[model samples]
Target: MTTTPDITLRSRLTTDCELHLPGDPGYDTARLAWNLAVAQRPAAVALPRTPEEVADVVRAAADAGLRVAPQTTGHGAAALGEQDLDDVVLVKLAALTGATVDPTARTARVLGGTQWQEVVEAAAPYGLTALHGSAPDVGVAGYLLGGGLSFYGRSHGVAVNSVRAAEVVTADGALVRASATENADLFWAVRGGGGNLGVVVALEIDLLPYAEVYAGMLLWDRERAPEVLPAWVEWSRTAPESATTSLRVMSFPPLPELPPFLSGRDLIIIDGAILETDADADAVLAPLRALGPEMDTFARVPAAALTQVHMDPPVPSPAVADHSVLGPLDDEAVATLLAQVGPGTRSGLMFAELRHLGGAFARPAAGGGVLASIAGDYALLCLAMAPTPEAVVAGKAAAFSVVRAMAPWAQASLVPTFAETRVDASRFYGDEEWERLLRIRAEVDPHRVFVANHAL
Candidate 1:
């Protein structure tokens, strides 16, 4: 008698779906994440088409004595780590892609595997927008659970706050509805609580009424960063909440496919979106415009076009990165930050970013999720990619050096989605809140079947 766990699980799963076991034909592709750098070797990868299928897979995994982990696009695979997959069965939701927009209800119902890009396209025709992140390719389920910080974030607050409902498959194979009026406790835990609670199969989320917007990016050469960066900091203080912006310094690789002007160059770029008139947008950006950036693409574009403004790499690639939330940016802190990652520094990071946070983000919602607010005036992120393992090690070290220097002024907490590296869950929540999250986790996931990256 051959005693194989994968074969047993396969026999238990619905026959209509796909399951890739180790050495199976599609196993490699099924386990790949968008980052490409994180090596994921799950015991088995299951593609479930419906919530029923997802629940079946979870229960089957439990029966086979295997932990379950659900991955949509695998954007945060690194944080899941090599150890997390040792005895895990990964549920891939690619086949569950479904998005429906209710223009009358002013909301959208998105399936587990749906990407933000698809939702944005679906809702654009209705003159409405979902609270999506900078990168359109990120999965909707993971983004919302991590307390998503969006371009519209300053104006609308964290994306998780807009979640009206979620359909989840718990560890016991029970399909539960979580909302303010439903399984309310589970609803609060899933929102901004990472994915440890259960597998979210679908979500009903609110949408913004935005037909068009004045939004785009401005770029200045690296040499001018010292002057322009501090100026942006000063300007951000008085900028209206209607406008949201971030400053980033990056060194572009010499890739032929890149634009001639941007290829193989280092530059400082300011990207933002404003829910206002074109003239008002220009007026808000006047001071920074006076700095004479080398490139300016700000204009009145359809809300759907906002996805392209961030210039994120559209395809999967290897990358190493880190993230943090910083206290207020003072003159001295600004100077120190620039000197480390600025033009003349030996930093190997591809991009170093600081997003201005305030306005609606500073206020707390009465019935909001565990992550009520980010607790910092700005959020900082550093990212890098290299071809070789040796280069990756060196590049990451350089990035961390700069991040470490900024630690004194940094907040202990960080958004779950942006928690690229492993840290204690305490860094993401206060002592009491963390304890409450643990109690909730114990209540719903007694066996701890659902494994999530940087999970509680």
Candidate 2:
């Protein structure tokens, strides 16, 4: 791979934005990704705080014959790491962050690098909230572009469907607006096409009207997986569209930093949002509650608090994961999953999760993007902490093992958000959708100047 000369890169981008060359003092820090497990060494890294700066950097990079890879928190860096970044300009958007809420319109206009927590907090006072992901620190651009699945998903729809418009800087450095009425095709492609076509600098997304929600978790010892797992799966099958939840068989290493209930323990967790009245939510949760969990935190809380319900690490950490969209889980399928991370099994995984999908999740939204709906019952995700190289190897093997074991019940499709590494991009969309995405990608980025986590 041929890299652009440092002098050429500096000459083009130095006046436009903050540029970090290979040997620059801040290059090492600027190139770090959220997933510490991924080591991405792009030819250079640029920090653009405004749309104009972003456009300048994009044009400069393309003029220098370098491909531009736009990244926010780098949560999905593993997928981008799979490519050759020797000739790529890593555009870190961490400096471009902010959010504005229009309560009257029930929408939020957020900068590309804004985190879910920012948007949640900004809208909380308005008694409104966006369909944010479980992790508060997750970048909005990457998540929505990849068809974000949320606790409100079953009741509403995938987060992308809530998007009204996006301001993107195309490969040619032209900033354009994409929505149902403006740059229509580009808008459709971007909703699920990820950052393959351009650098998304701003997005105006519709917010949920929920001021408060009934959501939380129920935990039981890992020993109860044999019983609790099946019960939750059964309940999920018949659960109303107003409820969305996930079941996880988790193993925690002995660490003093963790809470008593999670540290050095093997447990089963069931958690999510139940969009119903207090009485109605209780009735819907009766069956699972009957199983008698050691801890039940499900109750009515402010919608903003839902971002913390899943207890995702508030800070960046090293992790590796494998995922597959699964159809209805039968007895054999549940049994196979149990074999991998059952009570007595040493799966070496942090957690093996089955996010209950279906409900409105499987139905297409009107005027939605290419990835309007996920055609599966559950999204199976297995993740392992990978703080060390040896651990990364083991974690990958352990994670892939469970995914491979459950392949018989897995669907041919995948949810772009859950995918940890590069896979068949076509699996995320239908044949016609995939073809249309390709055509639009070629038109918007004829030279393939932009490289997204999941390339279209």
The C-alpha TM-scores of every prediction are: 0.96, 0.98
- Candidate 2 local Cα displacement, residue 308, angstroms: 0.8
Number of colliding residue pairs in each model: 0, 0
Every candidate's lDDT? 0.85, 0.93
Per-prediction CA RMSD (Å): 2.3, 1.1
Query: Pick by TM-score: which candidate is best?
Result: 2
Tens-digit lDDT track of model 2 for 1-456: 265544487788645699998889999999999999999999899999999999999999888889999999999899998788888889988999999999999999999999999999999999999899899999999999999999999988888999999999999999999999999999999999998989999999999998999999999999999999999999998899999998999999889999999999999999999999999999999999999999999999999999989999878899999999999899999999999999899999999999988878788999999999888999999999999999999999999999999999999999999999899999999999999999999998999999988876
C-alpha displacement of 391 in model 2, angstroms?
A: 0.9
Residue clash pairs of candidate 1:
none
lDDT of candidate 2? 0.93
User: Model 2, residue 91: displacement in angstroms?
Assistant: 0.8
Cα displacement (angstroms), candidate 1, residue 59, comes to: 0.7
Candidate 1 TM-score versus the reference:
0.96
The candidate that achieves the highest lDDT relative to the unseen native structure? 2
